[model samples]
Target: MLDANLKTQLQGYLTRLQQPIELVAALDDGAKSAEVRELLDEIVALSDKITLREDPTGSARKPSFVVQRVGQPMGIRFAGIPLGHEFTSLVLALLQAGGHPPKVDADVIEQIKALPGKYAFEVFISLSCHNCPDVVQALNLMAVLNPNVSTTMIDGALFQNEVEDRQIMGVPAVYLNGELFGQGRMTIEEIIAKLDTGAAARDAEKISAKEAFDVLVVGGGPAGSAAAIYAARKGIRTGVLAERFGGQVMDTLGIENFISVKATEGPKLAMALEEHVKEYGVDIMNLQRASALVPVDGGIEVKLENGAVVKSKTVVLATGARWRNMNVPGEAEFRTKGVAYCPHCDGPLFRGKRVAVIGGGNSGVEAAIDLAGIVAHVTLLEFDSQLRADAVLQKKLRSLPNVDIIVSAQTTEVTGTDKVNGLKYKDRVSGEEKRIELEGIFVQIGLVPNTDWLKGTVNLSPRGEIEVDAKGQTSLPGVFAAGDCTTVPYKQIIIAMGEGSKASLSAFDHLIRTSAA
Candidate 1:
């Protein structure tokens, strides 16, 4: 039910409307003032063109509009945020509010859906957080598909108290019966499994750690896989947790520099490495993420968002960094075709073609140098006043026969019809604009630390890199951070792998000391 202030506002509108007015995300929140009403009216007129799902029961209301009618009481309900994973939840809430009982699949899903029957569920999420939205939408869908379900969302930013009271911890935390219990990204299937837990009991089953491992590695990148291999070899029961079977290394199209392998694709090398580590009896938890880390015994306990926590003696955080995006218009539309982050992955596809490299730093110049040898021509554009690379590298780049360096120039647009055929540039000084024809664009604008989740928990450099000792030991005992994400520089596959192995050894030594004590 809406509070008094909100109820009065809704009632005033109910009196003026002829038919039921459709409610939408923008309108229900009072963001639509009189000035925006006309614009909204136009959008509503085109609503039929928009596709919508139907619920046999009205409890799951469609988002076309929220209605206030004559002689109607001003009772209101909130539909939680629909953006990110919560978007699916918004649909579910509308279904329940309109009067339909959504049939749940997994016993776990139903268990979560059938909260304590008192508090509402509010989940906040962002699209940037990749896996955060799934958990919320699963709950919302279950809530809407069921009659007794009446969940709603509060503005996460505005309703800080609501979040705290519910112990809303992170970007994607769920309020169950209006209480904060556990937070992490959960899939519909996983939630359903949780809801359907224990057909014998009609509720979710709670279990303790399977408790058979020491070090659990997260990510199958060079660091993670290497940690698993080393830990297992040292006679420590170990497991590897990776979102993808192979991390970014597998996505890397080419690697001419890994020792002994001469030239190979990142995926090929990762596959071979995967086989090598398996021989050592390392258990791989592929296609998964670490959802919770509970401290226990000699190390911390590891819990996956899939609702399974394993007991371990130590944890190695090796989650690698993701590619940076330009965030400009159409950059996403033509990513692999015209705009590329991994030059080695798609560089061969652009053989004898014209390409542009954005960034004036080491990566930018290195990519320019690499592509120059294969492409017809390479244009290196730098936004900085001057290239800040080392003199030796700068001289080497200048000497490249096919390279052209454009400094103090800003790229305004990556212009093309379907694929990247040209790029638009602006002169910071002369204010002149020029468009150059190119088939490819590689961006190396620097790297952002993917260690935001570990601040006070781990020692980090001023630049946010995880601080590792010579042996990859973090300040906190038993908590090891590795890979390009950490302080180790020269972000190459081999270096990250070596660091991972070292960290695993460090963790093993720490465990051994504790066990002997």
Candidate 2:
């Protein structure tokens, strides 16, 4: 159950309940069921407005519980223990079900309430996944806001049979109305856009109507946030357009290298960044992807994918980088079937299964070390003869009994039928081909800059990174680039922020000089 400190915190949070709520549990006599019962009892003990009831005939999933308003139908359900990353989701579900107002925008709440058809969303997640809570919490909030929507957060680890039967090889696998909806990290806006097909067109129209910005930031990662904040602080019109705020940082787990802070999670840090940016007069736009950048008569006009255009006096390109794909055969076809990129997000789905790590860098070695604890075995393939990871990490990886390492190995193909069953590789030393049977493959090779859209518009390096001067100025005047998308050496979050600030300053200086002339 909950510790004394945790119980005290839960009790404090329970004070926010404005109305009565019920926890109707559908549990068996197993150990997990007993644990669930104890948890429910402890929860009810804290709040007078909360009640617990056993509903053995409620859900087919044992050790499950439903959170709903008193005398109302169940809206949010948990099919497994809601601990670890999902603990926040559980708390939010309680507060939302108890008539506490959610922090979501008023328009979004209204949109949820207006949705036409009934939606039964079931999301499979692992407690260790950093990305699962966002999906779970979003759906839970939707369920609480709209009667037509109901959601169940199923822990894939606890329900092995269901996971196997559904062929779910990744965490945060979502299903709507008994069919596969999507697999991977998704935001509430993204989810809504998917459900409400007209949202994109409406959003595009609204974006097209916005006035020009003094400094417009593309991409909402650490770099974009810093750039927007710096621009806004200068008493200028600032705006940020992002496909999704937080960029790769949202997919990240543990972040210890950020200075001043001892350690923090990615989602937590991302939230802080967003909140900090919102304190200023900067206009924030989310779920907007830039299709092309065109240098207009006075400023640059960035076209959206939905045929809308946004003009800005100066633009800071901080679109950031994405996980590098192997580009081998069967890799694309089997994605989410057995191939995955984020180890922290998707590792739990492959528990007790053999998997391969496709690099020898720090990320690869670290992934192998982490997966060795949960997975049956790990085969690490390195293109280089010697591992490039830190010596400490290499030592730790070698100590793992279930891990194997291959040097000068080139991944030939990802082999499988319906899902990934193995992989083929070539040994440089022996000039021989080999194959290893594995249930999953984790690609930790590196990152590719998200500069494809700006390829013809901006000067790009051989590796497809935007080439920037010392002032973070790109070849195009009044246009700058920062963060992982640029030729900056280190792609650390702190470096990205600093680079973004520098880019903003440079863009501002350019504006002054041009206006003076």
Candidate 3:
């Protein structure tokens, strides 16, 4: 199943195996099973330390395989062809199962090994989902670290019955002990924090004891990374406090317009950004949400949700924007149960089912085009009289036979009992109400800045964006804002990077002048 170049790469990775590993497949006599067997054979051919064995009764799920040390108990399982975004997950499982050390933090490894109770994790994922790999890999790592922890990755597209029975309307839907645990992008640290209730308090204590920073950047998206790097390059003690490193960009799929880079994925770019920032002497604190900003004596104190306060001489607010919600009834209640924001991630879950795309912008039109290929039909609703998408996208959307466009339509409510069954909308021109039966609703309105936490602390525009001058200085002296959270016009990645750099320079200038006085 792997190509020549892929085989070479797989072979190189397999050479790191320090122990014997076995691929125990429980496959039935089916076409998918044959494919799985072929794949296992190809993988085993790469390394002498690897071997494949058939055990039709090993698991209840057919065409599945378990990756574990030769004499170890079952830990990681894959129920479908682990290709596409999950190919990396499969490779990592192989390497980790073969005794290759994972690159996780030493403290985290100890935490996983010390967990008392058993954890049986099952993740429902779609191949097209860019966020699924992180959850799968995290769970796999946990399973490998602790014998009490076991994980299984089930492809939602392949196992339709399980997804339907569990009412899984989203990708990366995680279940713990057969109960719904979470649904979305999650890292190892986040997962561990959820399991270990005392983790937050411990982390807060550590953060509280830290020394003050010369430059502190809030958020870890493109803008925050750039700001932190620039500040650290100036020989300043820079630190980044982020709710989640990469922010909304982690949920993004394709990125073809990111300057010199011809094409790349969001997670890939985010990884590069984190790696680049690590090259500097910047201290990064991930999974930290800023709750409030207090002006202290000669510095700003940023309060975290965990009750930890971090002090900085100069603060750069680069907290990025997030996907805007429709704010209608049933929208919040049915978030992962049918209402979704990412088409590339959840589109496969609604395959062969009718769905609705709300908005007339580029994102909405593009989502409609992408969903039309997977779903039975797509209804595109626009609040405006006409679509605001680019002409090329509009033309492509129009050409799709399964897509229906409605102009001057406003989404009112999402209707469903257990899951999403349909939606209600109003026809603006005709003054009529309409309902369409659909299994999914994709909201593509826009984005809202993450500046609500800074409401009374700094000057904010009517739209809640942080108000800043040309030099990226905010109303509060020694405080600067950039990226989508500020009043900057364009919200592109390159523009955010430039703005972040400018904000860092402005912060440094303020510090120098103030200290000289």
What tens digits encode model 1's per-residue C-alpha lDDT throughout 1-517?
A: 2346534543443343323324442332244223234333433343232122222243342222222222331122333333433333433433333333455436544465564434345554433333344455455565544435434444444444444444332445565565563454455554444445443122112323345578878778888888888898888788877766457665465588788877876645776777887888787655466665566655787666556666677888888777666677667776644777766434545667799999988778888887887789999999888997778778989999888899989888887775778888889989999989988888888766566667677778997888988988777778787898898888878888889989998889888888898
Candidate 3, 386-497: lDDT as tens digits: 9999999999999999999999998999999999999999999999999999989999999999998999999999999999999999999889988999999988888999
Compared with the true structure, the alpha-carbon lDDT of candidate 3 equals 0.94
| TM per prediction | 0.52, 0.99, 0.99
lDDT of 2 by residue, 422-467 (tens): 9999999998999999999999999999988997899999999999
Stretches of candidate 1 exceeding 4 Å from the true structure? 1-209, 253-256, 291-298, 305-307, 333-337, 344-354, 360-377, 385-403, 412-440, 446-449
Q: List the lowest-lDDT window of 10 residues for candidate 2.
A: 342-351
**Deviation in angstroms for 69 in model 2?**
0.7
Q: What is the C-alpha lDDT of each candidate?
A: 0.63, 0.93, 0.94
lDDT of 2 at 243: 88
Write down the lDDT that model 2 would get.
Answer: 0.93
